[model samples]
Target chain A: MKAFTTHFKNSSMTTTADFTNTSSITLKLEQVSKQFGNLTVLENLNLVIEPGTFVAIVGKSGCGKSTLLRLISGLDQPDQGTVFYDGKIHRKLNGHARVMFQEARLLPWLNVVDNVQLGLGKTGKGKALEALNHVGLESRAKDWPSVLSGGQRQRVALARALVHEPRLLLLDEPMGALDALTRIEMQQLVERIWLETGFTAILVTHDISEAVMLADRVILLDGGKIDLDVKVDLPRPRQRDNPNLIKLQEDILRRVLTIPA
Target chain B: MSINWSKLTGRITGWVLPIFLMMIWEIASENGWLFSKILPSPREIVQAAIDLSISGELAKNIVASSERAGWGLLIGGSIGFFLGLVNGLSRTADRFLDTTVQMIRNVPHLALIPLVIIWFGIGEEGKVFLVTLGVFFPIYANTYHGIKTADPQLLEMGRVYGLNHWQLFSQIIFPGALPSILVGLRYSLGLMWLTLIVAETIATTSGIGQMAMNAREFMQTDVVVLAILIYALLGKLADMGVHFLEVRLLQWHSGFRQ
Candidate 1:
């Protein structure tokens, strides 16, 4: 373990990270820590995400995976660290980033189109339509949100989050509530959109296979710290039957299950 | 088959019960089973209504009362709504005025009819004042409550979007509070009618309530009953009118749209 840490430290000192763009220093968390009352959540966490990387945070219940996303999304404040977007400190959301929650949270009063355009400014409607077309909901623009099926509603929510063309997309277990079939479909839709848009995406999920399937890097959080950072070398449109993904999922499971409470 | 029959019977009974009650009242009065002086038969009331209708007295009284109530509601409800918004949005204003307003609300406006008469004189101004006071509280209360209860998450969303204060209120807060404000309007309508009756009773010589008072003075119980029935019917119509307006304006609202 000492030799491994020393080797990792040596690699970090020699590493000269090349960002995809000069402007894409991307998202960085430096020695971040969070505490709620007396309970410590995230402690001395550090991560550097490249632009357009699809990263998944996986952890057991109460392991502060969602807290990490919230911190990255600027929904919550950090106690003792910084969240940098493109090397500048990111503060509260000012429409450059969007978060999609487990529930669709589409305003029921609005129809499909209007809800997509919601919170977006004056020129939002056209962009919203484009987004809806991306999600295959152009025909349901005038239809009320309540009439939509669960998957369709989630798709609309996806459109709403994307309509603004945000650089950062945060998904907080968005497919957690769906059934197995719908979940798989949604997972694929998410992956396709991420590929098409090339937005920096961060997802927090409990499903290890899902993390292994969708993420470029799966960060296993245990006891409010990164337990394992596994790089998924598999290519896009990965199959569920792929042995590499299966082994990676098993490895992540082992790391999480072995963590001391 | 049984369920359909039951639904059909329910519809029939809804209309049947009222008609049956009227019939019983008519029969009891005509046969002298009930005192006719205190309670006139339905036929007498209908005849009185026809007579008033033919003379155009019912129409004139309705127009006058409606005008007073309508204008009073328009002016008073608007003031109350703006004040409520101020009270909700500004803590300084709320702290300054809430106690005073609460004290005033406690004092029944009807009981101040004599005082209002002395202050404004026995004229249109006095009657309108009474009606305005009566219609103001519900609108004010509901508006304040609506604005106060607007979802904080939506407000946070506005903050995230870089919306200015005015834009936030207009786009997010106002639309969010619309349902509550409409509810206030309904309550104000009811209060408008109540105040109009008191206003006409004490001061006005020319409205529906005044007409009812005149009929009572002349011991024309049928005319009095007809006047009251007209007032009740008109109040119901006003409620329906507001409901129609609500549907038109808030068609995007899920409750009304569905």
Candidate 2:
């Protein structure tokens, strides 16, 4: 484990130097209202995330959490207002942002390294190898994506997202399909990478415990609006079983359950 | 130093039944329990094959038939593949061409023999045209289906990663549709032989079908049987070729690996 940590640190140092221009981004969504036909998914939703901050949006299904992430990523435009990136009005697809979806979505025809290279767009086997190593998948570089476990595939997806060195990383329930142990491991890996890279991350998940475990601030959404915005002022490498963390998780869970459908 | 014993055994087992059946047929014919006038014995068929080979007739007929099939596949397969690609990738192309193609596909290609003969006049052109028509639809349908049903999620991911149109089509769309396209190729190969057999038997002078027709006029059952066996062997060889291609190309597919 110690050796793995040191190796990760060494690789990240090189990546940091290579991507020195990729500073973190500030995201601001001002009165962003989105409607699909008559069903309003997000209504005048206002949000501001500081650079390098990890924020998790926790909401029930149909609460427009994924839609909000899509809006921020510029995949979908809000009907009413604007999305600002670094105080500039962002109009088209957000070039500085990369989204990790619920499914890994790796090309089945390509091997592990080739799929990672897809993230690079052009030829860069060396850089692809580095990213694969970051995700501890360098050994399986030549293997197909179909052979990987759910967690391992998601890790490759994370590596693909990170290879671009995006200023904003949007995660739309990336770990939602993982098993309990694998999900925890992925959470730790993501947290460790986020800490090292300092990229702004916005995770949309239904798991409150996961939100508390990873994010600096947990934003609870109910009926297309933010119901609660709580700051998690905790130390790094937080223990899941820690009394304070558990109490906060339960408090958030209780609040989430109290909202009427 | 080590052989794959199980694989070897599996191959040996597959041949056992066919060899046993041939032996039975040979013994039955030798003992006069079967008449050679209707269905010739295996030995007689082999003798007929040797005679044809010695006279160079078998080689000539085989070459003629193969060339026709090859040319037809090259032209028809190329047209089908490109059309399928266009329709699969673009809604406009699909709207303009898909309905017409599907309507034409419903017409039995072999049933157009009368019109084909009239249009091209019993020459090599008619046979090649019939084979081309016969080999086109399955490929077009399968390739289009494969592309149309590609995982939208993967395409979305490709877009998010900033792949341009050409990159997305070459890297994602083409490989994703390949398995289905190969299925079309295999199906089209079978149709290629079937259409050629009909076309040749109906109006040709140089192919294996014509050789069989000539043998029938002289009551040479052995030569007729030989021709039938040749067609069967060719069809099997074509299928094996496609299977080899699938194994090589779809190594990443779990079903094709090993």
Candidate 3:
């Protein structure tokens, strides 16, 4: 209910971790900051992603990119500031929002498909299988998560996040644990799934190119603030070989690398 | 499944020492190196088993002991499980009763046989009470520990799901505590047998333990040995029953694999 002044810095370092314009918004955060005891992780953050948009948050290790996602996902509350979804205060994740963690975090006791359907109140077994099928893991439905490959496990996690038909999807470095080849494959799978689902996605990643390739707009966060908000303007299904994407990636990388060591 | 005897050799290896000891006992008895009054021959024990079977005494005693154990498990285990859940979930209840229960746990239930006899008068109530006391603490302690030790991360997941209190407990806390609860049940079943034996020996007029005590007075070593064997067999069967139930109930668990 309080008016929050937005600070737009000339350089990448001074803006809050999330920076968005009032001109177009679906999800918005204003003057958000979070602190744990003495350490400040997010400071006066502001951002917006339009309906069915994919936004990538890129930051160095301690810049609170994941923390920002956690706040958005309602996994954690911001100590200060308000997050709005569809003009309503984003409070907690209901069936409307779901998060996929980097570790997959599948229930080990559950089979792959059951793990996908976990905590889906009143959902049918058939629909659960359909979600697994959508993730191309129908054959491994009855298999334990422990037996699945890392890529397969992540696929199961993706299915789980999708099963509830959430309007918003939060990815917290979901591919960080996968090998290089697996990570690329999973990135492609995720991109295709996001396009198919038409769900608003906010991805937090350390990989600059991952942000550029996957996000419609990429925000580079440094020092608990958004350093730069680069619009991809690149076409849907953008390829890694696209010159503009490559240039954008180079630019984001240069901005990120210029941060104080 | 077809054949893996080499892998099973360690399990089979344990039987060798027991068989060797039994053979030595038989040889010693046959050679009169041991007094027949003190140590019955294996054949004598077998003959006593046949005699008891003819009289239907062994069957009746086994049934009696088993019934006591069954009742003890049903009542004690259920109470312990529910109470454990309370102690695990409610800090106030835990604070009030935990120290009291710990203090009571230190008093050996078997040592209270005379008191139980005086209270219940060598009746079935005393025997049942003894069995219940024997089985209660282990199940309660383990269930409490299990609930306490449930993964906090999974609990965070439950919170993210917006599960209400009952939903959280039924879906998350209960399932998480199941492995430990099952372990407790197995241990309690064993204790049930132990307590039933002590109770029957002290107070009851029937059951396997009573039959053993009766045989001892008459110097019927064969009957005593038979009763002891029945007790061992019953303990093994009770354990197996609980184990089978655990496997069926928690087939999803990783522990079920081995």
By TM-score, highest first, what's the ranking?
A: 2, 3, 1
Candidate RMSDs in order: 4.1, 6.0, 5.3
Candidate 1 lDDT over A1-261, as tens digits, reads 233234334332111122233322389999999999999999999999878778899999999998998898888989999999988898776566788888887665567898888776667889999999999999999987778889999999899888877788889999999889989999999988877777788999999989988987778898889887766767667999999779778867877888876
True contacts kept of each: 0.25, 0.61, 0.31
**lDDT score, candidate 3:** 0.82
RMSD of candidate 2 to the truth, in angstroms, is 6.0
Candidate 3 colliding pairs: A12-A227, A16-A225, A16-A226, A17-A225, A17-A226, A18-A46
Candidate 3 on B42-112: residue-level lDDT in tens? 88998999998889998888888788788877788887888899999999999999998898889999999
Between 1 and 2, whose DockQ is larger? 2
The true-versus-predicted C-alpha distance at residue B102 of model 3, in Å, is 2.0
Model 3 alpha-carbon drift over 4 Å, by segment: A1-25, A121-123, B1-17
Better of 1 and 3 by lDDT: 1
User: What is the full ranking by DockQ, best candidate first?
Assistant: 2, 3, 1
Question: What is the TM-score of each predicted model, taking all chains together?
Answer: 0.88, 0.94, 0.89
The candidate that achieves the highest TM-score relative to the unseen native structure: 2
Where model 2 places Cα greater than 4 Å from the true spot, the runs are A1-22, A119-122, B1-4
User: What lDDT tens digits, residue by residue, belong to model 2 across residues B181-243?
Assistant: 999999999999999888889888899999999998999999999988999999999999999
Q: Deviation in angstroms for B9 in model 3? A: 6.5
Model 1 chain B — which ten-residue stretch has the worst lDDT? B154-163
Preferred candidate (TM-score higher): 1 or 3? 3
> What's the best-to-worst order under lDDT?
2, 1, 3
Task: Give the alpha carbon lDDT tens digit for every residue of B138-236 in model 1.
Answer: 999999998999888667655554568997788777877888998999999999998898789877779998998898898998888888888889889
